[model samples]
Target: MNSTGVVLSAGDWRLVLDPHRGGMVRALTRRGQDILRPMPEGADAPFDSACFPLAPYANRIAGGRFTWEGQAHVLAPNAPGQKHPLHGTAWLGNWSVETGEADRATLLHHHAAGPDWNWAFTLRQHFRLTADGLEARLELTNTDDSAMPAGLGFHPWFTRRGVSAIAFTAKAVWLADAEMLPTVRATADTLGDWKQGAALERPDLVDHCYAGWTGQLRIERGDGDIVLEGEDTPYLHLYVPPGQDFFCAEPQSTMPDAVNREAPAPLLPGETRTVTMRIRSA
Candidate 1:
């Protein structure tokens, strides 16, 4: 069997993963209908996949610069035409399959200390398909002898064609500047209530992080509703590009430039942190 390409299936749910291509979920379907945007066959870019894991950190780190333990560290932009290092190295690094079965698979990635991060770490991602939905778990462990700042998240691209409404509760939302960095935080009352729900159609491009998220989101589509639940994720980054066929409802542990914000939790040597997400259709 090709370890690079693995599929997990349970009941009507099927999930395809590419461990060599940033360990991304190439496709996710329920009864042959895509629950997430399906990547074309042979696609190697993680950005084009149905979902991907974010580890060591999530989102961007302003200008690829951060100071940890009084030492300045710099990271080169991993994505083309972008100034900041995006997501994390886990999505761009090769992952080795540690175990697999008919309905579940686990992949592992180890990072050595480099100029970009300046610390070593190990990341593990597990994908499992249940009768009604999918569950994903990510764990990050600091392997270096010193403490390191870390964050975890999952970026999932959902089909936006028939999405009618989105509902979630957040205390505040971060407004970004032209460079996509947080400029100001607006309260829900001022920004508008997503808790009661809001129309998916919006006039402006939506790419911002909602702080103090309730870790629950509902997407109402023409065929059915997709419910997302996260464990220990306090932030949600919503990316809805106008005139696009896909949108992302990312469950994140921190906002963009989290390292500059000093928001990520510090992991001591040999310490591990984990995050889990569940997606269900109704």
Candidate 2:
């Protein structure tokens, strides 16, 4: 089956959804070229690429060499660092369309049982269009003969232009190594404070992950505000690239290096796991 893409437009906002590959919201824009950066003449265009995932996993995995169940599985690197296996293959793989109706669509994909997870899997992603905003849900189930470790999340690029203030609550903070991987943990106060619903205004460089989130965030622009409420996501990662057009506010389950740490409960065969998030114009 071909990759499925759907467009939802409201006034000046346009969201493009591709169901086949992790059901990613591949593009978001009004004029489309507003975020264009200078590219090499004849190079592939950025707009043509998928918008990427929004959670559980963002960015890349080094060399795809993580150990699970004492076994190593190689993953292909799809980003700048050749040393890392970027984003899960589901985002690039084909997804079957289960149902499509007005304002909503559902898509599904399956991965073979692996040695580490030991379970066959089926994942479903849902998209719903509404006058308030767009909502996307990702659900996964262990369909294998055994239980396995699983991680899930979102990776959306959000508009950060003229964002005067950002306010939120955080409880946990992770210390990262030079490679940008989580290495340590401490009380949020160690970094500053564990304040919730506090306002931060273009304060400084931030590419940090925070846990103990309430799943409620508000981004205040000069003229408008956007509210994002995450369901089943207790952790949040805020990525603000220097002088970049877009920033990412991701909600995720399972911390980085979960596979190595053998973190949390595994998805048992016949059991389902899900994460959902809602975005609305405020």
Candidate 3:
């Protein structure tokens, strides 16, 4: 392993993580078959990796604007061409390896109070490979003196080849505007019977947040089924671009633009919140 990379293996599964590259899982494979989309060699962008952690908050904040506790804050877009603050800062920040073994590894990243969000916190990501699958845990603690709005999640990109169906349960879904910001909330049933599973290929692009999620999802492929289960995550974001090589089934603690909505949970000083994603193949 390199200075910034860690590998974990158990049974026929293997996971590669790079602490220097947003602490992302660069590759996930079972018996030499890609589960999540593998990162290209030398790829440094967090979005290019198989999976990355979302901390403090998840998804976009409209025009990078929000108000909390009587104070207004504006976050600059981290991406070159985006107008909104996409994802969170932790994914692009360097993390230090806290522990590593053949089957598990832990990484820690600390974000000091700054103009970006004006909050201090510590985030921990743990990855473990089991006999059947991989388990990931994200824990965030408020290190500041005042309470702060926070959310946690994981964005995993699964290879789209031969992906025939998807299954999940949710009560409502958010319709996005041209800029991909939430515009309206609609009953998920209108999107079809996703609970039983739905065809993967759709004529239109899908980039919406499903509210009241059951914290469970399954992606059916030609070889096997990939199941994702989350704890303490009430929202799931589905990003399936037309003709894309990969799709994302993200499990988040809150909805997109949560800082502007009522979804973000407040974390008091010294308090910690955790969200876990378990991945298994059937």
Largest lDDT belongs to which candidate?
3
**lDDT string, candidate 3, 94-211, tens digits:** 8988998999999999999986778999999999999899999999999999999998999999988778999999999999999899989999976667999998688788889999
Steric collisions counted per model: 0, 16, 0
**CA lDDT of each prediction against the hidden true structure:** 0.87, 0.61, 0.89
Ranked candidates (TM-score, high to low)? 3, 1, 2
Query: Which scores greater on TM-score, model 2 or model 3?
Result: 3
Candidate 3 accuracy as TM-score: 0.97
Between the candidate structures 1 and 2, which one is better when assessed by TM-score?
1
**lDDT measured at residue 230 in model 1 versus the true structure, 0 to 100:** 92
User: What tens-digit string does per-residue lDDT give for candidate 2 at 1-282?
Assistant: 223366556545556666554555655544333221222233232333434443223444554656555666655565454455544545655677788765677878877744322356788888776767767788887777766666777766666665665666767777666666676776665544424333343556566677788897787766567777788888777766566666667777766655554354667788888888776677
CA shift of 97, model 1, Å: 0.9
Q: Which scores greater on lDDT, model 1 or model 2?
A: 1
Cα displacement (angstroms), candidate 2, residue 23, comes to 2.5
Models ranked on lDDT: 3, 1, 2
